[model samples]
Target: MDHLAFDDFPDGLIVAGPDGRVTYVNERVRKLARAEGDEMIGMPLAEAMPFDDLNGHTWMECVRPYDGLNTRSAILEQSWYSPRGSEYLITASLKRDRPGGRVQQVVIGIRSARVRNRHDRERSDLVATVAHELRSPLTGIKGFTSTLLTKWDRFTDEQRQFMLETVDAEADRLTRLIIDLLDAARIDSGRLTLKRGPVRLDELTERVLRSISAAGSEPSWRMDIGAVQTVWGDEDRLVQVFTNLAENAMRHGHGLRRVEVVEAEREGVHGVRVRMCDRGPGIPPEARQRVFSRFWRSGPGAGSGLGMYIVGGIVTQHGGLVDIDDAAGGGAQIDVWLPVNEPEALRDGDDRGSVIGSGTTRG
Candidate 1:
């Protein structure tokens, strides 16, 4: 094995002894520590590389022997300040190895995480502030529109009809924007709450299908519900999940005529696997990795990038996994996996639950 190759690795790497003393520091590690070549090699692990976690834990304290393995490991995020009064975020992982029956050899890898965290935090703050500012005006508009519609008999027929149509269109637009803002806020705060409950999968799928049909947008849409009777989850959130998937399929499915929802149990866990397959030009392989990212859209005509982001967040909050893959015959398929043991209480109206857990749909 070429030790030099390891030294040149992208992540910082350091080796420590059983006594928790640094024995070797790779080039990357030395550079990150801003230390001389020999300074880090002989010092105690804590003193040679001092770092503290966001929650105030020392770096060494967090890396324990890996559970059930001779090696211990941990990934830690810590902040460091430069002599010039600037701060940097560092993410480091330590792994203890027992190679050749030696238990004392510990390797630590470190990298910069400050820029990423800062960017994410800033974006979240912006979303929250924008959502808050927009809510009051949206509410006012919707309220006045409702009042006018209710007072329809007081106006002439022509005036009443025109007002009603204008109000209806404006209300719809406001509602969509509000929903987007809410989703953005929930995702930014990581506070979406889930009201989990035991739900019949068959009934839930049927309800979503009927609701989408009643909306009368996609008359040619088709849904296939599986035989799985019960799944543990928030029914409303789950509906939002499917609704987003179905809508995305309809909108981006390139004139997709039919949508399908399939259910099954796998490996003893009841799973409701909903696949929204469309006939549109399928997502390119290069962009598949980002399909679920926030504010990500495929092209100019694609809808707001928030839909898939909301879908991913909702499924994840339920302890389920969601992904986009190539459909069996054509188009992109959004597959969602929900655990059967998802709590029934998550479906209740507990607004304070985890923001990620609240399955709210966004347009």
Candidate 2:
């Protein structure tokens, strides 16, 4: 059957004859079985590929392919354990000569379960993180509002203000989380378009510092704005980027000390760079690779864990990059670089399309 065609398939493929004996099998099948030469050919299909179900029944015993109802045409993909106890996913297509007829051939496909298992783990992580963040603020807001509604006159003016402020802060946090989720969705779907423009790095950093000060930040903070030129990017999105980076520093950086905005010229690319340095225990070397990944966090906090991932997407969209390193003295440093070269055609408010496609919008 010119078995070479099936041998090139990535997943394991095996064909069983009408009598249920192995007619053909791929290299992947042989490799999985650890078979040598043509040893796998002509063997009983069940013995050649001994995958067992949760009940410890082999495929033949579980499915009873030749003995099943004549209407059955396929076996759905599912997880099973091989003879060596490694997990795998297997599926089958039963080729019949006619409806209600006996199965003429059984074509089986199998692959390792690692990729699906990893994706499932990541999805579970996202769900858990989102649920935790959502519950915290919602609980606070609900408790405070219910209390104020039932006992407004019993609380002093200062107490009332404190309660209201807490609610407001929680609301803002919820808003930020929602926006971050939307931004992440847009980035993932390649629909995150930038309204191109020239953004003043100095002015932007000043605005961020002002916002931080208004938030009642401590005096431990300092800034040094260098003679950097205006960068070509989206002003509002860049603000979101800087805000997330600065907030991440404050939240996880333990003792965030300073932010330095300076002109950077690297590899003939003239642009501006912002460094957020802290005095807290720095991130470990191994954990740095996961910094820009979605829903990643070092410890517990109010963050949605989507901040760094969004920041990375925005910076990448701007023809820039984001990296983490040890701070000047200690702690962790997050450096962001945005190139100054703007396409002559793209201007402020111009839809520059998504970063993935550059000039193409999603259909």
Candidate 3:
């Protein structure tokens, strides 16, 4: 095999001689260990990439070559904890030149378990959160439909219509929840596709506000459109951002006085800004920074915790930024800063951007 190819391998690689002396290491090993030069080449395997067993003995001693005649090869997976508190999945394979021959070398492959474990936990938490979120709407639809079907003759027209409306609303909620899961998957895979175009921020805000009104949500919304209303972005995505923010305001704002959206420009900033402010219980100081994190919830009845994350992702895709702060009068304020002009790179899809998934995960 070409040795140079190993340098490009996705995982770290280390080749040790039969006597357990480091002979070669790929670029990944150098990067993972933050090593330089030939410092790691002549060192013992454990010395270069240290690992201690439960008994405090070197990992090398625990997996040392077996003496029996039939013991020809061995493979094991172990967790390697770095001095810097990083974790790696270490897969070590000891191979003999031929069956029953002397153990020639041990090939070790290392990958960052920290990133993998984090993603796994997030996925697991998402599945659980989705299941919990789906139960309420599904139960509502089923219970109402069952009751209506059994008591068709006993119900008044008004009662029947009310139940049917409830079912419809619950169904819509389920659809939104499912769409969010799909979008999350797409975002994770980095396959989020955006249809870039010129979007009017003020018009989009009005449309979303009208949507909230039509939904029968009782919240006063105030809009302020500044000089620059149009931006280069995906129209549908921009609409989604507005919709989520409006809904979030309705759900979280207590004694909800009103939702105010303002689009303006700052003196030194290069982009147009949109601020969504509500006169309700504002976010706490510490929780402000984590509102946009996936599966993060600061309080009960907070939607699936995916709303702000999705909002963050979409704004970032447009090369914009979203931040949370206290509204002027004791409420939560979310500020979205978007560039008036789209960068040539973003328009051409040449820049790497994160995908924004929608749906609520409020508890």
Query: How close is every model to the real structure, measured as TM-score?
Result: 0.54, 0.78, 0.66
Q: After superposition, how far is residue 222 of candidate 3 from its true place, in Å?
A: 3.7
Deviation of model 3 at 237, angstroms:
1.2
Question: Cα deviation of 98 in candidate 3 (Å)?
Answer: 7.2
Off by over 4 Å in 1: 1-160, 255-262, 266-268, 342-363
Residue 71 of model 3, lDDT score: 66
RMSD of 1: 13.3
Q: Candidate 3 has what TM-score?
A: 0.66
Q: What is the C-alpha lDDT profile of model 2 across 313-347, one tens digit per residue?
A: 99999889888899888999888999988566653
* Ranked by lDDT, top first: 2, 3, 1
Summarize candidate 1's per-residue lDDT along 100-162 as a digit string, tens digits: 343545566566666677888978976775565467556656765777768856878787667
